[model samples]
Target: MGTGNNRTITKTRRKIRDVDQIKADLLCARHLEQFKDSKRPEDLPGLGQNYCIECAKWFDTETTLKAHKRGKPHKRRVKQLREEPEPDPRRIPGAQTTSQSIGQCYDTQSAHVAHMEVDT
Candidate 1:
């Protein structure tokens, strides 16, 4: 019984290691692809100022911008924006069109709120 339990534990550890290795490989591949693509200047407007239009964020440096690109909140916001573009407060029924109201609309979203807090 002791030998059987030892073997089971060893097998489980091996499986975990294998999975971890596979994840590492995948991440490496992803980073390689990003690095290759990053050589070209982004077609998006406002390049040089470290502005992330998707998150409405401004990073202090290129290193911080690169790191922010890999972060969870930015990723989530990117995905969300891709799936559904931000609604125009003026176009929405019963929504106020003032700048304060429009800003409030953005603030209510979790991803925006998270990034805004981090900036401050």
Candidate 2:
């Protein structure tokens, strides 16, 4: 019913990646590596069980730890930890609060789940 010239002009939008976002992602990855290394023990514990300080999770055995390493929740946590800034020790309330544990930052549901797991 209308002339061709009357049709609305639709512009094709260009997909542009944000440089800041890229930089932030790189920074997050670096921070995550640092955080992970900060808690890693030079020698494996005598106990068979292995602990993940970042997620406040304990693997009762090496097999369990291997499985946990490949799990989605653990992967998600690694990404989340990468993005989060380190907590300030001064903000923590304790006589000798040199560092804040990741357990203290976990959600109630996560805490409950961690607690529900029986150490075998």
Which regions of candidate 2 fall more than 4 Å away from where they truly are?
1-48, 85-120
RMSD versus native structure for model 2? 19.1
Candidate 1 lDDT tens digits, 12-38: 754422322333333355533443355
Question: Against the correct fold, how does model 1 do in TM-score?
Answer: 0.31
Give the poorly placed runs of model 1, Cα more than 4 Å off.
1-48, 85-120
Which lDDT value does model 1 have at 107? 29
RMSD of each: 17.8, 19.1
Overall local distance difference test of candidate 1:
0.49
Summarize candidate 2's per-residue lDDT along 1-120 as a digit string, tens digits: 856652334322332223333333344555434534655454435242476544555456777777888899778867765665565666544434233232333233444422332221
